[model samples]
Target: MNLRLYSYWRSSSAWRVRIALGLKELEYRYAAVNLLEGEQWSEAQRARNPTHQVPVLEVERAGQPPLRLVQSMAIIEWLDEVHPSPPLLPATADGRARVRALAEHVNSGIQPLQNAIVLKRLREKVPGWDRAWAQQAIAEGLGALERAVADGGAGRFCHGDSPGLADCYLVPQLYNARRFGLETSGFPTLLRIEAACAALTAFQAAHPDRQPDAPSSDPATSPATSPAAAPAAAGRSP
Candidate 1:
């Protein structure tokens, strides 16, 4: 299979898909979509995804038509289904439900509110509303995620000892939380899982700074170098 990922360096949605690809040990070409430069609004991108979002995965197989997958969660789930060695989901139905709930807490409940387009509109219509709104939305969403993980039988990760689907979503959302200046010190369980994730090669390779389109010299804003980049823990799955 020939895989190409349309991604933006700072996109949390794209970050999730990158982590899934790394964990699955899949090799893919990186097609950088510069969201900062309005590349996603171009006619080409609109044809790729009507939503005009980053993280569109293009799959090509011999003698078959190419498949264009949109939305981070859908793309990640498809990858998991096709490449199941290091399963992104749990084996049991109940466990799968729990992980999906946790993932959705970030994907559906949190991310859309602070999306770039949403924030841009907020900035234009209600001056000074973008940052404050993003901070509040992320704070509230993260607080709920922290409580859920604490009460949801979490082990080394959001669902179990191994990093799975929820971890993929959680790590990137936490990066956005920090980027928005939200104090993450209150979420111990989430932070612990994040630390565990940071140690893995998959997460490290998937970080925004490691992407080809990332700004070359912005160490202060780079999550890979930020204070939140915790020390690696032992026994983390690859």
Candidate 2:
């Protein structure tokens, strides 16, 4: 299993990739791409991903092109597809659909609206967009997600008693939400799921603050962060 993950320590997408790798118990090499320093823009990374993103999965075989894959969601699903050790998708089609829906709520909906790029754009244009609206948008999205999850499962994790791809995506989105000082106190389900994730070693090992490149606690680190963001959770099961 000659696998390599092109990662940024603080990237939520990269974080997702790390969680997927850890949950699957796949030992892969790590290649750091410093997003804060524009290292992702290098011709080398661009040749690999073409999207200029972190968390590129370089799947090497005995002799192959070393298949470089991008987009965190695709990478995670790919891991599940190839490994299939602990299935990331549920057994039934309906179960798989439900989990994917919840995951997409964060992946497709919330993430794009309040992404780093969007935040940077808003920061330059509007005065209060930096902390104010970003938090609001994130909260609103999470609120909707909470409602959606209510229609699914919220047992120990987002989709079931164990974590899946949905949980991986959810935790990172929640982490980013908290980064903007969003009021998640109203979202009890989200909080509970986050708690469940924190108690597990896999999730604990994948935390951003635990990573080397993550910054120290600072008021200017953004308004949405708190001391209570750390937690552990489960993953694909055999």
Candidate 3:
């Protein structure tokens, strides 16, 4: 597809892009942007995305400069629109709205509050900020999400039978929620949906642990196993 993705293995937003690419079966070159090393703020990366974020999809066309697209949800939506075979959003506007709402519950409500940058700032400013602060925020958002799903009559996935954009957003946030030590067993519905997603090849391929840049003890540069394994200040999904 002549696509190049600036990505980080652990960033939820980047993870979302990864899942979308996998689901659409679109091949793209991956450029790892080491967010924990402050690489997102570097001149080259910032030139690609002024927001200095990972998960920027560079769409390359013949005889033209690569088109840089920023933000995970926006990028996913674009992918859905451009590659419409297996649709990410449902056929109905109402279904699309419901999915978007669920996705936002994680992308905006939970992720923004709990990501490395926001949590770090809170800890720096607050008297005794702890991971619990993020935990509480995530718990609240998940609780609301659970209720929304139950009330909306969610099927195997967030929308109907098929996995959609909401599922993409949910899985990564759930991963981060566990990393931050939040107890997610309370949300049985989400847990069920997560398990279903786990069985999918696309979701499995997009997992942080499966990424080429995933942290490893053998590789010092591995973000997962390194001393600086935590995500950077601007590390959350956008």
Q: How much is the lDDT of residue 53 in candidate 3? A: 87
For residues 1-238, could you state the per-residue lDDT of candidate 2 as single tens digits? 5677777667888888878887888766556677878887888878988888887887778866668888988999999999898888899999988988988888888888887778888889996667777777788889999888876576788888988888898888888887887767888888899999988766876777655345752322211212212122122111
Model 3 Cα shift for residue 227 (angstroms): 19
Give the TM-score comparing model 1 with the true structure, all chains together: 0.90
Report the C-alpha displacement of residue 39, candidate 3, in angstroms: 0.7
lDDT of 3 at 1: 44
lDDT values of the candidates? 0.84, 0.76, 0.80
- Enumerate residue pairs that collide in model 2: 178-224, 179-224, 180-224, 181-224, 197-232, 197-233, 198-231, 198-232, 199-232
Alpha-carbon RMSD, each predicted model: 6.6, 7.1, 6.0
Kindly state the number of residue pairs that clash in model 2. 9
Q: Residue pairs in steric clash, candidate 3?
A: 117-233, 215-224
Best by lDDT: 1
After aligning candidate 1 to the native by TM-score, how far in Å is the CA of 98 from where it should be? 0.3
| Cα error, candidate 2, residue 140 (Å) | 0.8
Candidate 3: regions farther than 4 A off? 217-238
Score every model by TM-score: 0.90, 0.87, 0.89
